[model samples]
Target: MREKLGKISNFLVSLAAGIASFVFTLVAVLVVTDFNEKLAASLIMGLFALLIVWVASEQPNSSQARAVSALIKRLLAVGSGDLTSPTPAAVRREMPALAAAVDNLFEQVRSNLDNVHAIALYDPVTSLPNRVHFKREADRVLKARGWDDGVALLFIDLDGFKEVNDSLGHAQGDQVLTMVANRLRIVVKAETREDSLAPPLLARLAGDEFTLLFPRVREPAEAERIAQSALVALCEPFEVGEQTIDMGASIGVALSPRHGTDLAALMKAADIAMYHAKESGRSQASMFHARMAAAFEEKVQTEKALREALGRSEFELAYQPQLDARSGVVVAGEALIRWNHPYDGLRLPDSFIGIAEESSLIVDIGDWVIDGVAATAARWHARGMAQRLTFNVSPKQIERADFFDRLRAAVERHQAPLRMLELEITETLVMKCGDRVIAELAALRAEGLSIAIDDFGSGYSNLARLKDMPLDRVKLDRSLTADVDRSEGALAIVTAVIHLIHGVGCEVVGEGVERREQLDLLRAVGCDVVQGFAFSEALAETEFLDWVRDNAPLRLLPRSA
Candidate 1:
């Protein structure tokens, strides 16, 4: 009784002492404080005495202490990610409020982690798994794949998406993207329902680039069918807020265990195929092959070398002169670029022009050509060897927003007379370019730059449209003039084209006139200018200048004019 009640007796004594101390504190604080301060102090002292008694009674082995220890262990376990472990009832009953707070905190942390993961792994706009997640899923599928399992990846790039974004605002572009995503989802989901195959994994790899993975397909054709379905779905024009937009997709397909066994290889193959499809004209699909990757790698190497070539000044112009059929003299010269490659000897325009055009290196390349041609032609003008210098202009350069501005700047910088510089565009470019492009060309023509439709019969010929275009010359493609002497039908076609071009007040030029009979036919058909291997091939600058000196009275137009 003495030992047990001793704790209570000590607590009573401590309570008495605390009361006296509280009174002293109130007296001291009352001097500088209010009645509320004294009342709070007395109550705090009483609670302190009871806390001491409770602390003394609850030893390390007491139920309260045991409950606290159990709670600590549970908290440590929770911190260690053992959320499934049960919370002890002793801890909860002893400290219900604290237990409740800990449980809520645990859930909150878990929720935050999940939300962070979702944000990191998902595209918010399309609500599709991102590239990282897609690659992870691909790896998982590949690992679990059976011996005969074939997985296919389709890399889909939206054709003309940049155009839409440029013409319409970004808001409109976003709407278009969301709609496209929805269409893809619907098409893939619908196909999955019909076939008992596992659902296709769709992901938005990046802006305007989406990917579809068939992880459990038995054959590559199944992947292609899904691509077809998606393309068909996109074929229908999308409507956004009273405006209808036309969009197309280019797809590249790669099969697993054939094209590649991993995500990187498969994506690479598909990417190459997709790029090829885009180049071959959009709204198409292509399959990945080993050769495709090899070709792509080669192209990349070539592009890099081309950039170095530009920097090293390894390029030069080879001139091929045009002759007057009546006078039998060289009249004007066409400036053709040649790359004097260090190891590959001389590289022709055909070897690299397509690559340049595709990569938009043409813009820089065209600038280089313009500067070089303008400077060279300026020198020729000073030497009385002046003739209208014709140089091919890429279609992309014509469409560039800064083309005219840059052209005018280059001409001024080189002090080359615009009248002496002739820009030749392919018929394919002129026919497809917007009216705005024609308007730009007219502005260039206004500056006295002559425009010729090069390779006139190559395609996209609208005779009526040609009349409206500002033109000074029409170069009939070599195909129309190749067998002019061998076939009367060819001569008739050439004669008709010449007559039609003459009617449009444009001079007619025949290309690829190698045979004397071809020249005779061209003269008979009233063709004004002829260029081919018959008279002279494209020559180096020195060779051309010497040839110009050798052939006197070959000037087509006066330099001052």
Candidate 2:
């Protein structure tokens, strides 16, 4: 009540000052119009008296102006961030409604900023804190730990997610991703203790990729346990609409101080580890180790060397003789690519083929392989060794837009006999290279070339898919042929494979038959051909020809199909 009375008193004082000024102006005007000395003197005296009265009245209201100044100061303070302090009641009394409105506006602005920060820091889909929040938390916590407390980052990528997206449609794929996100959150929560300092934070980094961070990790086992729990939980089939889907995760774990003290370094190490997991087999996890770093460097070197090797003509094929089981004669040869690196002696296909296939180098390397083998076959044909020459074909090579054209060109350039140039494709190529590959292979077969299923029993055994393929032969994979001599189970598998191959109108070739006993077992199973070290290891063209010349009746003399 006093505050309102003070405002009313100030208003009345201001009104009195205005009235005093108006009376002084009127008296002066009257004195000027009269133009008399006595009248002017009287008017000046009255004006002076009125001015004195106005000054006296205004002096008592000085505190009101001071109060207004203080109110302005308080508003400036609010603008400059003295947020907790409220405007004084005396100053607010000068303008109560305006003061209250300003305070409310400030609060609304602060709230909007907080909400904006949350929107910027969290993922809309999962409602989980996002990469920005993760990095911020990781950086601050890791620095605070100071290499004393442990920190771990788990980088996870979904396996076969692309297939799921492509086959089941993206809506279903998103449902799977959301299901995975929920599963990850639940598992991480269960692993963390109620009073844990810096519990595990699970964030979806991007589509089908997530990173789980454990601050004050304490030990590697904890991270691994969390990883195992998350993976096991994630893989459980998710039901969306009418369908149930199975999923798998590849996890890469990296620890602080050991891997690195920062989020970027830890993430990189974890990514590399995750890649290793995928390479070993998806649905598994690998911890960051020094050896994995070395392996990564080696792979980089191999990629560089492979690119150089192709141009330097450092790659060569070693022909492994495949024999006719019935005749015991070397009827054909499989061309295996070997890289004789100038720095590192000989590198087998297993050592570098994966690297090549992953990079753009595969296309060039594959082209060279096809060309070199075709040229070699031409030479063998000229030497009266008309044995068919088969070469392993990478799926990438076969899936190329110009694969058929390139193969045709290579054969024509070398004058290779189409019937004698066989291409060996893996089971993955047969089953998973999409219909494009199948259609292309069918076209290639129509051109009078033979296509064989290489590493047969080792890959997806889909008979329906195989029936559609134009396969000339099924080379029993090395795994099934390794111990067929002693293991009844092994022999039984080989027998069944041979029967299956024959049923599909394709011949069976036993691979890696290192013993005569294995060979006898394969022959008993009606294997049509065999390729192994037992007969002859892979050799250079000169050595291979020499081997053929020395062995009687094994030489590929001019023979008709």
Candidate 3:
């Protein structure tokens, strides 16, 4: 188009020059003939110059207009289709600078558009396909697969993620999520290579929620293996900034055309499976089964029943005496919690404590236990049956912002002597958050309450840690007592543990002492206290009161001399 305009402009200038030359020749001839004729020639030359300017500006050939129309059509085609057209040589030469600039602009626009599209389809944070793109790809893959073949959708939800955010802050939480995403990517990539079929697609659905679509999975086991790998990957500690956080994930997997034939169904099934994974225990993976759905429905009913039970105050405490091994005297009684669900009857910790822990009902439940046990102990103290009352403390409860304040209030409310209260914490709990546990224990001990380590040697049993921690006593794990008859190693370990704990000026209590030999070995090993079926099981509140009254001086060996 510009080339045509240039040609017309040149022709106009040439024509004007020819006309001016002719007029100049005439003026020269007139000048020679008569000097007065020069003015007329000048007037004619000016008229030709004006005509040249007008014609040069006009599109006389209509070629420039036609070329412009063609150029616009080409540009529209490039916009609609692939933009691979080359600029014409004529256009380039006629408008060299403008043509070059336009070409560069088009290329830049194309590059930017590509980037925008890529980001829209994939998350920049994880580099995984976003939900929008994953759904599209999953549908395509499922539709193409034969009925005999199967696809699996694994939904992964991280456990305790909120704790990471709460304790470490959101920046560290994001770092952990990024690390999880990277691990998932590696696992999915590996699976894709193994199958050699339609490779699986992994995506981040939202915060701490990710999805993996395995195409053409050979069998249910393939999906199971993938889920297991994901669980293992997530179980490893995440190194975030200066701290290492133990972040774990639960995965639920559902197979297409089996669990669900459509996206919504598949998603629902996967969600249900994920819930099961969390309910069964965090840091595990579960596959969708018909029974799991049934169990989930039952769990929903159980949760409702539990909440109702709580409102009705149907929960109670059972006391088991912690006997001084040498004298057989009940120096303290450990408070064992029981849920007297109206419908479910008496329930033990094994049945419901897990549910409480997962739902964070442990804090409320733990408080109830503390208050009820403290009140019972206070009553006993008023009746001249005063003995230390021990209650278990969950890690979740200890980590609460108001743990110490709430505990202090509970003791004051019950008017229970702080010296007669003992808090039993598991070794695993202590090791999980050592500094926090130590500080909390020190505070509680300073308040005149005793602290005992429960299930000692069940976790990182560092002797130095035990010596440094603010603990008054340690409870030997039941495993050690159970194996005392079968393994000399077990007996030696118990003996060493007792000596070590005593060396640190802390008392040792033996748990699960069911047989005479076990009790004898524990006493011989210098255990200060013993509690198990060997004496009696946990008793009802009234039965415990009577037993405490009747068994006044509980003697272990009847003062053998």
Candidate 4:
């Protein structure tokens, strides 16, 4: 095109010059020759001078037109995807100035296209692949035998996201989400192998929801390991702005061709596994299993029933007397929780304590135990029975923020003296969060309530910790006391524990003292209290009160050695 235009322009210029030269020559000839010689001679000299000047000026125009034509050709070639064109040396001086601008324009166009595509395929906030693009790519890969060997899909949902959002506001919640997304990305990238047929893809499906697709997993174990890694990654605290928030994710895993063959089925299986993870306990990962579905459903029903049980007041307390070893008199009674399930008859703590602990319903159950025991103690005081009342406290109850306040209210409501109430905590509870538990125990002690370390020797028993704790008594665990007479080792340990506890200014209570030899051993060891079937099993409130009345210490003579 540039060549054709150049030809047309040159021809027009040549024609104009040719016409002028011809006219000038004709006039020169007419003057120089016999026909008007003076006029012709003057015209010929003027024409020759003009021709020289015109030729010199016209040469630059032709050269300029040729340069422009070459430049136009180079530009057209570049635009048409023919980058092999050698830059015309003749036009380099001028064209080089425009070359960089053209190159930059092309670069800008490419960059803009890349940005547009990125926005379409990724979540703006997290920069994780969005569901739309993930599904599209996954489907393409699946169709092309991308997952022929093995692939695992994990669907992760944040367990306590709603609680965080509700307590901290949406801004903090969003920051947490972003942190979680970053963590997921790092975990997936680290676990995925570079040489694998297909690498893992991480996507944020929606609010507090993320998905990971691990293509070309070496084995099922590999998928499980990756899921576990994801769980561990989420275990750390997320620093969002100034606040440090902790959140956990429940991951559900489904392996392709095993759990399902397609995206929808695999996602469903993963969802089921996720529900199982939540049901078993949040903050864990679970693989798809058919049995887990039924178990998950049962847990839902059980939670609902428990909530209903609370509302219907289908709970009661049973009393177990702690006997003074010397006089065989009841020194105190321990209150035991029993759930009077309407259909299941009566259920013990072993059946419901776990459920209660998980759902935080133990707080209410703990409150009920306190109130009932306080009322029992008040009744005994009114009847002139000067004995203390003891109730067991689980770690959950002791850790509750309102524990002390609730206990105070129960004591006040029933007019029970703090000195006559004892709180029994397990050794494990005290050791789990040692400093805080010790401080809380001290506070309770200062309020005039007695504290006993229950189930001693079963947990991580640090003698130093026990001595430092504000405990009034120590109850030897049943395992140590059960075969005291038969096992010399058991007898020695029991004797040592009793002497040690007494030396620390704390009384010793021997639990599960069923046999005569056990009671005799406990007595010899100087145990202050003995509680078990040796006297009577944990009894109903009425049976206990009746036994208390019949076995009044005043009626029994002191035993002689």
For 1-561, candidate 4 gives per-residue lDDT tens digits of: 655676687677777877777786676666555657766666766777687567646654444556678777877876776645555665655556665555566577667778998998998878889999899877765565554577789999998797678668887788788889988889987886776666777898988889999877647788889999999999898887777777888999998888878898888889889978887779999988878667656666777787888889988888887888888878988888888888999988887787777777878778888889889888877887778888898778877777877888888999988888899988876665546557777987998899998889886787877777898999989998999989999889888888888888899999988887888778887889888876777789889888888876624334537
Off by over 4 Å in 2: 1-133, 169-171, 192-199, 240-242, 358-360, 378-385, 399-402, 412-415, 549-552, 555-561
Using all chains and alpha carbons, the TM-scores for the candidates as numbered come to: 0.73, 0.73, 0.71, 0.60
Each prediction's RMSD to truth: 7.9, 7.5, 7.9, 12.9
Better of 1 and 3 by TM-score: 1
Per-residue lDDT for 219-289 in model 3, tens only?
A: 78989998999889989988887898887888999998899888888988898999988878678988899
| Predicted candidate 3, C-alpha RMSD | 7.9
Ranking of candidates on lDDT, top first: 1, 2, 3, 4
* Model 2 TM-score relative to the real fold: 0.73
**Could you tell me the lDDT of residue 206 within candidate 1?**
90
Q: Which of the two, 3 or 4, has more lDDT?
A: 3
Candidate achieving the largest TM-score: 1
lDDT of 4: 0.81
Global lDDT scores for all candidate models = 0.83, 0.83, 0.82, 0.81
Candidate 1 residues lying further than 4 Å off, grouped into runs, are: 1-127, 159-176, 193-198, 234-248, 278-283, 398-401, 431-440, 463-468, 483-504, 516-526, 552-561
Per-residue lDDT of model 1, residues 105-147, tens digit only: 7788778988899988998887889988988887887777787
Tell me how many residue pairs clash in candidate 3.
Answer: 5
| Candidate 2 C-alpha lDDT tens digits along 66-153 | 6677778876886677766776676567678867876787688778878898889987777777888888887877777744788888
